[model samples]
Target: MNDFKQELIRYPAARITEVAKALSGDLRVRILETLGDMPMGVSQLAEALGVAQPTMTINIQILEQAGLVVSSPGANREKICYVTCKSILLELPVKTGDGLHRIEQIHMPIGMYSRSIVRPTCGMAGHDGVLIGSIDDPRAFYMPERTDASLLWFSGAGCLEYLFANPIPPGVPLDELRLTAELCSEAPSFDMNRQSDISLYMNDMPVGTWRSPGDFGDRKGKLTPDRWFSGTEYGALTEWKVTKDGGYVNGIRATGTTLGDLSLDYSEPIRVRLEVGKEAEFQGGLNLLGSGFGDHPQDIVMSFVRSIDRQ
Candidate 1:
């Protein structure tokens, strides 16, 4: 096994062709499976798989290039190969050309929150994985460097609000509004069992609440920098959506709030707020991970779907 022991990896669309091509060969597939069982030298792998050294070397090169396997120099200059991920996840967009709807998406960085109300155990970090300003200091959220934050966390109760420019074309009827983020409970160091109730608001209207299972730190996040060692490695990807009917979180009904309740207008900005209310049963706080620090290489994403037929 590798030193990092990375368990899950999510690839971006840019690498789909390379990864798919690398796995196209049966020999390369077998090599990865074998390495998953145990790291081995090239010669040993060749012998076990009934392949010659030259063939093994070529196959290993492909896997290495695809980032499916990692090889390090061993004694006698022999190369030791190890599988990099136990599980791989990729999100593919599905496009249906029926022309019934148009979808617009925008990525909002975690640090770009326009307003915040936080307390102790609150801080932000940039892509460098270094903490900005001081830890547990609310003032840190106001630092100019905040716009560069790739990750942020807080304990107790507070709210972070962001304003997203409306992307729907004027006079178009909205169908569904969706927001997604990588999130989890916050704890000092780390605790997998801690729970937190996180709430979402759109245009100052309560949307719903999500009770996160825990703060995950069992393994290092796929995108978390090697330099980051202050705990809280990754988070669960959560999506909240609002439609004409009601609000939903991952397909489950979360609130009676509806799209009409938000009174969205294409000319106005959308105010999205995430908070941990003081009255919440679980005041576990929250950790919001960005593209540079989570298993998913994305920040807060919002999607606006417009009804093509409705004027």
Candidate 2:
């Protein structure tokens, strides 16, 4: 229960889904319980769970990602791990003056874009993990089944736009605005060195830019399809939050543009755009990961964090 990380967490409401996903696995839960009283190595956990070392590693990674576990280099090249959360309590969204905030979230499928401008080296995949058309074809993005896309990627100057029904409470001014998505740099094939400057816009105003380090190909994505090949295996799940001060990427300050700068209002559906600026220093491409192609289990997730009892 040495959950110092969670105890002093700067943000909690925003991470509920990640924590839930981590606790969803039966085996992961067992590992966490086994490490309750003491820290152990990967091999020890595997032996205790009667699973292979690789399987244990993957499960441990998920736990680490959720911030429920911590791992450090042990003696003799072994990795020591321990539980980070003493306890977890789930609460229904409550309205009690300023003590609590409720977050409203929605997911947008990859192909539900209201506007799509992409170049060659682009295509969409459905829930079945099959490509809608040949690469370098824009028409593939318009396929009817695109609503089922579990993953999407593109290169050169490109972007996919989406609309979200306004969820801001009538009387509550937004306290924070955020967007979460799994993405990576796009390469012609599987080059791991590719990079891209991906940007996000609200109501046609730029909020911030995230510089993707590379087109990831280190290993196959946890949910990636077995048939897909010669391309990226997956990408990184990034979170961007905007407030009065500015825009933050994964909790780090990224831009000076504040939420008010985006001009979001309840009068109409919010216009959300994900794009790779052609003028960006790195125009490698864009890989918008979906449920089947990234570590996260969500599509384009947008959040409107509002004070339930704005007084």
Candidate 3:
């Protein structure tokens, strides 16, 4: 087993190419994709794909050689094959800006909070009081150009803000502003119909608002980490925005300043804020997974762009 693991892990680029060439069959990609989600026996895979067991085994061997799949002994000593690769992070050969057009990517782990409470959620705030973290914790502190964040908490009626010090160059028209965060319910108990109303503000004006649903509080979510996803809970990747016309969510035009109603003036500092509150009759609280939600938190990504035509 050790030799097998080492051989798979320490393969040189030339060896990898040789293995790829060996497995370059038409049905190999489909077989790998099917096995990527879970492990399965050869008989089961062959039956599902309407192929003979021997034929399936031949393809599996090719995939295993390519280091794209792994096989092990299963129940009753049957052979089980599974995919080991998670994702493909590739760097494209493209030219960007010299200095000012640099793009920075940062990753922040969540689930590191020891203690969190409501009424003051975690968020990013600028030196000039622009909030960016969560809505309830409007006074959260943040630094400029930093992407990953570990915010604390937020309540029913509060806001979190983040400020970007990189001033918008004068005479440059702001092209777009976007904000995204993973949200879940913080309650110990589950409640259906639990909702958290969030709003985005720019320079103290309403930009957009999104109503997020809390988990059933019964079990953890599917995509969350093991420690966090084990319980009966639910959350989602929520985003909203403001445009020249109005606010929108997932592309649908939303009425009111739900986030799409405001615009940024690149000629000055960019201020972003998040507001959390209860709808007229809904009841729920939010657990914001910033840089401190779980064992593997997410770095909140915020972008402020200025168009060349606007300049």
> How well is each residue in 1-311 modelled by candidate 3, as lDDT tens digits?
22232222444332434455645676777786667567789998998788999999988888776676788898998788877665432233232221232222223233222222335433432222233454444433333322333323344555556554434444434455555566654343444456767666666666566676764445544433344332323355666555556666656666455323344444554455655644424334555555344322454455544454521
Candidate 1 ranges with C-alpha deviation above 4 Å:
1-101
Candidate number that wins on lDDT, 2 or 3: 2
RMSD of each: 11.5, 8.6, 13.9
Q: Stretches of candidate 2 above 4 Å error?
A: 1-101
Order candidates by lDDT, high to low: 1, 2, 3
**lDDT tens string, model 2, 1-311?**
33333443332554566778888999998998899868899999999889999999999999898778888888898988987756666543454222333777788876788888888788887656788777678888877877788878888768889999886645567778889999998887767777789988887777788889898877878888787775777888888888889888888887787877877666888888888887889887888888877667778899888744456
Q: C-alpha displacement of 264 in model 1, angstroms?
A: 0.9
- The segments of candidate 3 whose C-alpha lies over 4 angstroms from its true place after superposition are 1-99, 102-117, 120-152, 216-234, 255-269, 278-283, 291-297, 308-311
Against the true structure, candidate 3 reaches a TM-score of 0.46
lDDT of 1: 0.88
Candidate 2 positional error at 256, Å: 2.3
For candidate 3, the 10 contiguous residues with the lowest summed lDDT are 95-104
Q: Could you give candidate 1's per-residue lDDT for residues 1-311 as a string of tens digits?
A: 36634788887654666788999999999898787758899999999999989999999999999888888899899999988888887645333322222677899999999999988888888888999999999999999999899999998788999999986655567778999999999999889999999999999888889999998899999999999998899999999999999999888988889988998887899999999999999999999999999799999999988776642
Give per-candidate clash totals. Answer: 0, 1, 53
Ranking by TM-score: 1, 2, 3
